[model samples]
Target: PVKDSTAAIGLTILLFIIPSKLDFLHAFDKDPTKRPTKPAPALITWKTIHEKMHWSLLFVLGGGFAIATGSTDSGLSTMLGESLSGLKGLNEIMILFIVCLFAENITELTANVAVANIILPVLAEM
Candidate 1:
């Protein structure tokens, strides 16, 4: 229904803000049928925020970025690109299949972003 990017942003902002104003956290109460009668305490407490955050995911994302940067700096992406250049004459669907198969296998071995960083340059060169 959103006609433009600005409307989409506005709708997203409204979705986020309206729920807090309406005591959305009450849905987490132990008794599902009973509505919370009292005003909810501050939702953004340090403990709550810390518990909700994925610390492990942060480390993985950081590692992925580091790997991407290292690969680019070491010309690894370029080397990979050159190696795959032989497949340039393949049919589009076949190329797509090969790329998907390669991506799936590589992603199983490492983080997806890392595999993407390593493979995107190769695809671009091709």
Candidate 2:
């Protein structure tokens, strides 16, 4: 596997440029259509990307990061950690079970990264 970031990115660029230049993907076309006498529209364009982008999901994730930062800066994570520190006396399996249950429930309401960002500092303290 390529471990270098630059090499990985270079490989990705080559894959994209090579296919576009050679029309390599046409080999896999399942829909055989008549050849057009006139030019056809490009498959992807700036307008297509703009309309297809999920702007709301970005904002939701950004908000989640902001919340995580606020919680850490405001010592909410410390407080939460202190509250859960009592669990040190509990069995490791019980602690793991509780964490999984909490994560499972919270994940239903938000993105996984959002939950991780919010919970990481608290877990670190614990």
Highest TM-score, which number?
1
Which model scores highest in lDDT?
A: 1
What C-alpha lDDT do the candidate models reach, one value each? 0.77, 0.70
Model 2 regions lying over 4 Å from their true place: 1-46, 107-111
Give per-residue lDDT, candidate 1, residue 69: 90
Query: Over the stretch 1-126, how does candidate 2's per-residue lDDT look in tens digits?
Result: 667878977865555444233344444566555333344344444576589989988788777877777877898777778887898889989988887788789889867776787677667766
Q: Estimate each model's TM-score.
A: 0.61, 0.55
| Position 59, candidate 2: lDDT | 89
List where candidate 1 sits over 4 angstroms from the true fold: 1-45
Worst 10-residue lDDT window, candidate 1: 13-22
Displacement of residue 71 (Cα, Å) in model 1 is 1.0
For residue 11, model 2's alpha carbon misses the true position, in angstroms, by 17
Please give, for residues 13-74, the per-residue lDDT of candidate 1 as tens digits: 55544534455666687887665666654424456657898998978887887888998999
RMSD of each: 9.3, 8.3
Clashing pairs in model 2, backbone N/Cα/C closer than 3 A = none
